[model samples]
Target: MINYLHREQILPAPIEKVWAYFCDPKNLNEITPPDMKFEIVSGGDVKMYEGQVVEYRVEFVRGLRSLWLTEIAHVRENEYFVDEQRVGPYRFWYHEHSFESVPAGVKMTDHVTYAAPFGLIGDVVNAVWIRQRLNGIFDFRYQKIVELFGSVK
Candidate 1:
């Protein structure tokens, strides 16, 4: 079954600043949890653009390292970008990052749609593990972003 996660955060920063930070593929490692050992294997040097491909290595399941390949499917400067998985542990993964200027600052939203592998077993795993793991990852990201960009208050 397909699963979805949506999150929004108001960052105390200008849209251009937040957009610049997110546009650099390398910044992903900065926001990701260090325990995951997330590393960009290649294709992370330049700013994100439609058709850009990025490869990464991360320890996700049972601490086993896995390779993830993704392509930037769509990009609208200072607005939004979508990335789709090409090769990864998941059966399918699509993530959209969007930004809007709010009275407080920049409102950033993350929308993720993904499906697990192994059918019924995958569903069970997601129910017990993957779901929480993904939440934790995003939680970490939120904290890191706040630390880097300051709080909305």
Candidate 2:
């Protein structure tokens, strides 16, 4: 069962600043929820560029470690980038990070399409837990972004 999630946030910063911060692999740790214990296992210093691959370990399932690997499949500098999961729990994971210049500030959007491991069970999991967990994760991310760059307008 494929599912989608979208989140938009206005950062009180210029597009260039926001783009640079988000495109840096190091800042990923800063925006991610601390409770997840997210850590970059590889490509920590590598810049977010097309073809760049990053590996991370996150304790999302009850403090158990899970490995996730992603590749920068597409990039339009200062505009948007797409990261596709190469190896992970998800059957499919594609995330697009887009930024636009607005009068108030930069409008950043996160668009994700993913499917869990099991089929029918995955659908149930998404409904019962995965979906809610995703919402919580993104909610945390949104708040952290606001804390870092201040709220929009």
Candidate 3:
């Protein structure tokens, strides 16, 4: 079954600045939760593009490390982009990162649609673990964003 998560925040920064931050894969580690130990395996200044693929090593529950690969499926410059999982724990994962210029600043949003593996077992796992874990990760990401961009006014 497919599950969804949505989050929106306004950053007190210009759209161009926020766009650069999100597009550069190198900045991922700074926003990710420290506990996850998320690291981009691919080296150098990674730029986001329609066909670019990103690889990462992430530590999940119980200290189990997994390799995840995702492809940037779509891009609209500073407007929005979509990344889909090519290889990961999920049966399917599609995430959209959107940005809009607002009166206050830039409104950034994340829309995630993902399905767990193992059918019934996956449902149980998502209910018991995956869902909460996903939310926790986003919570950490949110806090980290606020720290880097300042409190949303």
Candidate 4:
């Protein structure tokens, strides 16, 4: 299993504001890396009520394009939300996102647990470069959030 943690601070923003950014499916492409060419193929509804399913098409490294689908497993308004993969690149994917109102701004956290499709071979590939790619994607997202929301401090 691949477990990852991501955290960010959005300055002067309430938990609701941060949550809005996350729930809006259209904004996903804004936060994702441009190089990845991410796009939502279906489920464009911005309001993520419980049991919503989101489907996306993403171009990987300019060569492969894949369809990814996830279901909104749980949601607690501005506090937290969880999405589990129904079908996608990974054999298993569970991502939980949390938001907290801090003194300075809003603290956002992402915890992802996933397993690649190809078992041992996929694990090896993940160790070599997939992990780094994932980090890069998050880095791009962080920068985009900072651009959209400005510094929290």
Candidate maximizing lDDT:
1
Error of 2 at 51 (Å): 0.2
lDDT computed for candidate 2? 0.90
Q: Could you give the C-alpha RMSD of every candidate to the true structure, in order shown? A: 0.8, 0.9, 1.1, 1.4
Model 4, 1-153: lDDT tens digits are 664656655556776777887888788888888777788888866688789899998876578888989899999998888999998888888888888888888878888887777989988888887778888888888888888888854
Please write out the lDDT profile of model 1 over residues 29-102, one tens digit for every residue: 99998989999999999999899999999999657999999999999999999999999999999999999999
Model 2: per-residue Cα lDDT over 1-153, one tens digit each: 789999999887998898888889999888787888999999869678899999999877876889999999999988999999999879999999999998899999999999998899989989999999999999988988888899854
Identify the leading candidate in terms of TM-score: 1
- TM-score each candidate: 0.98, 0.97, 0.96, 0.93
Model 1 residue 140 distance off true place after TM-score fit, in angstroms: 0.5
Instruction: For candidate 4, give the lDDT of residue 83.
Output: 91
Q: How do the residues 1-153 of candidate 3 rate in per-residue lDDT, one tens digit apiece?
A: 989999999999999999999999898889888888888887325688898989999988668988899999999999999999999889999999999999889999999999999999999999999999999999999999998888675
Question: Please, what is the whole-model Cα lDDT of each candidate in the order they appear?
Answer: 0.96, 0.90, 0.91, 0.81
In the predicted model 2, the residue pairs found to clash are none
Question: Clashing residue pairs in candidate 3, if any?
Answer: none
Question: Is candidate 1 or 4 superior in TM-score?
Answer: 1
> Model 1: which residue pairs collide?
none
Candidate 1 to truth, TM: 0.98
Report how far residue 131 has shifted in candidate 1, in Å: 0.2
Q: Where does model 4 exceed 4 Å of error?
A: none
